[model samples]
Target: MTDTVADVTPEIAPSSYDAAQRRSDAIWQKIESDPSGLRMLTGDRPTGALHIGHYFGSLRNRVRLQQAGVETWVIVADYQVITDREILGDIQGSVRELLTDYLAVGIDPERATIFTHSAVPALNQLMLPFLSLVTQPELERNPTVKAELAAAGKSAMGGLMLTYPVHQAADILFCHGNLVPVGKDQLPHIEQTRVIARRFNERYAGGEEYFPEPDALLSESPTILGLDGENKMSKSLGNTVMLRMDEAETLKKIKKAKTDADRQITYDPEDRPEVANLLTIAAQSTGRTPEDIAEEIGDRGAGTLKIFTAEALNAHLAPLRARRAELEQDPGYLMQVLRTGNERANAEADETLQRVREFMGMVY
Candidate 1:
């Protein structure tokens, strides 16, 4: 781990934490040391409704971290919409709906500040300087950029799409975040941020580490595969289970969900990915081990597993649905949350931008 404070080096270890309690201790320790303020930055692009894959993947952890007293900032990355041409048409509406979903899902404005990428101009300015620091080979190596290029069917990628990792660095460093919650797939982005932060501090902080080398707060949850059991759960793929899905829709999806051909049920992702996907979902939703769920439903047939998984999912989502319904009644309240959060976020971001400008001798 990189040292964020003078003479203080963070410890790096391959954690024993299961999918739930994985990075809690390490995160808490960092927060404890910087109680007055420890910044955390995380966000999603405004594309569509957040699904169960999102809830179980990272948003759930964001709520817990916010409540734990870490200063959290969630950005609605409206600017990233240009990366995927399809989303550009409805990006505005999607941003509004995404904020509504965020409030409904327990991202409290009082506890965490939320803002839109388009609303922050200074943050965007950091991207240009950041681009100069990183090379084309470095950007090309980013896994997400490669995947996105393939997804967009772009044989020759645009410069903006290729340098997204730099934009992500600006997102975190703009807010001076000390910790960022990200999955294994996003580890490279955080790695890039560390390099940028270190380079900036070394060159600009007058020999002092003004910006902390942010640490990755890894999720303990297993990567939630999509309902198709083929790839990661995603809204675009139509394989996601929405967090606010009604009982009927939930059941309908599960009924048609894929499963293994074998008559016997087993939790083997490698050998039987489809069956294992269901078991993983069941385990996560019911707080049971995949093996335990498999044994309990042994020889019951896929129908039984589908029914049970649907019921477990519905039960798990009961509170979130109720909370969402209550929040939906007052859309203005959610807007206010974003408005207030934007103010706070802008204030914090401005502070860092000011420091950066002064360091680079852009202003006296």
Candidate 2:
């Protein structure tokens, strides 16, 4: 990847690209040397079950950080689900499914705190002062927010939607999470969070660092294109293989996945995106380069390539699927894991909130 990492979202200023690269590299180096000293906050909205894209993209990194001994917090962001949409579909089930995926993929709740956004009141409370620190122009300038609004076909941005980045800042700062794993599109959010942290410490704490301005831990994972081969893998599009899917189900999905007409298979993303996407999947599963996978499968055609990719993926995910099945059988255990994490997160949030109140003389 270049200095920009990937095709960055428009909200991130083009000028900040190289700077972000430098900062990301430096933070990653520090993490490698002293992983235990860092705190990381990263999560997803519990909208639905996770898929291969989520696995290889961010979830893998989350587990790696947790195993590396970083104090990790995975917020379900339940409240943010309604930021754009009016309806809240099966949040309870969604949260459970997300937890199952988390555990099945080696995210130890004992090591990483996994909690809901709604459960932590103090975390939400931090959003108030954080909202004050950022200006209206700054909020409107966020490309991700604008893109989301456009995607959702909403002419007017909701209050939560506009201040979404503020909520994110609170999520990170409330727990003193200084290392945030995010892709290029989310880099601007981390930058805005840093601005909020800087302004708060300067204006309220007399420039004495109260919040560690979080750094973006850029993900090196390639964007996993959907089975359609045209768009990014998305559940809504019916083009994803869910993590909970069994080996047979996954193989069936792969068999039906879109592919090119050319018989001679090669890894050329610009030209043969669909075939290359399958190769990428196989490569990620087998820990081999996509180019190597393509070379090995030369002239085998899409049928052979699909079967090869499916087998590799199934082999990689077999253990995770077995673990997920066990977790599903014991619903009580899953809830207990979530409840324990929520309690720990609330305690951490309370301490941070009390200190913030003291800093601003609102401790009455």
Candidate 3:
């Protein structure tokens, strides 16, 4: 598998394409042939600041994958923000912020393309044709759709909300992505993408594979509970600790977080959720087991636990915070990174779209 995009020199290269085009083709070929090489597609809806939940849950894994030489594409799911529609006013800012967060977390723009959904119209258009491949029953059975509906407190759901897994399928298949880093709850989305890929190939192009069946790259980190300690960490609930928070702010949040009032700390998640959550966070930050951390801090009250957790978390995040500040100081540089990434993403997406059109007999 090719680790770097092929060099394209204009005088000797094909007159019809530029360096980016040549590089994209090289990447596509590598993805097709390499067994261990991963073409990853994963993203978050651009609603607000990325919190610890996103970092531990997905971004951490992404950094590891990229450093290991995977060709990664991080999408800013800006279009999906319209599912609720109330947050539309800030989508543009949210997209920029997400890019910032990606860079801050060590996702190299040179190594991975970080792009916004709005920038990839061809990919989004594929959703319409792709939607026809799956049935209503399949869509209705998707756990993510059900969870979203329940969260919204609605008996009825929007078409987009119901068929989101298809849209997700489009995100991966459009990129010809072969691996998706996701949590357990999102396993169903990966399953749906695989089904859609098979269905599309079987229907449009027989006897050969057109799309790769994307596999899940499961995260090893514990499910990060919100500071509330009752639900998944989320920005909307204001229960999250932002990735860019200062040391003082991070310490304050952890110090004030809810924990079991019991005098001794242990790692029983079922009976002592709040204290267990603290232990999990401590363990994740330190690369130790929750029990080991609890034992090490034996007989320590929740105050000592919170302080220790805060120190560990701050140590881990300090460098990220510093990098974020440096990146944030230069908006032009950040925009250029995203713009270059989007260009690379569009080049690859356009090639796949062309193949899809040809397979479906839409070629002119």
For this target, which candidate reaches the highest TM-score against the unseen true structure? 2
Give the worst 10-residue stretch by lDDT in candidate 3.
Answer: 1-10
After superposition, candidate 3 runs with Cα above 4 Å error: 1-35
lDDT of 2 by residue, 207-271 (tens): 89989998888898898989999887777789999999988999999999999888888899999
Better of 2 and 3 by lDDT: 2
Query: Which should have the higher TM-score, number 1 or number 3?
Result: 1
Best by lDDT: 2
Clashing residue pairs in all predictions, respectively, total: 2, 1, 0
By TM-score, how accurate is candidate 3?
Answer: 0.88
The C-alpha stretches of model 2 lying farther than 4 A from their native spots are: 1-8
Per-residue C-alpha lDDT of model 3 across residues 1-364, encoded as one tens digit per residue: 1000111111212332243244444554554466265788877887767888778877887887787678788888877877744447777677778888889999988888888778888888889779889999988877666776766677878887887788788888887898776555566677788889998889987947889887766555678788878887766677788998999999999998898777788899999888898888888888888999898788879999999999999998889999999988899998898789789878888988888888889999
Off by over 4 Å in 1: 1-37
What lDDT score belongs to each candidate, Candidate 1 first?
0.76, 0.87, 0.77
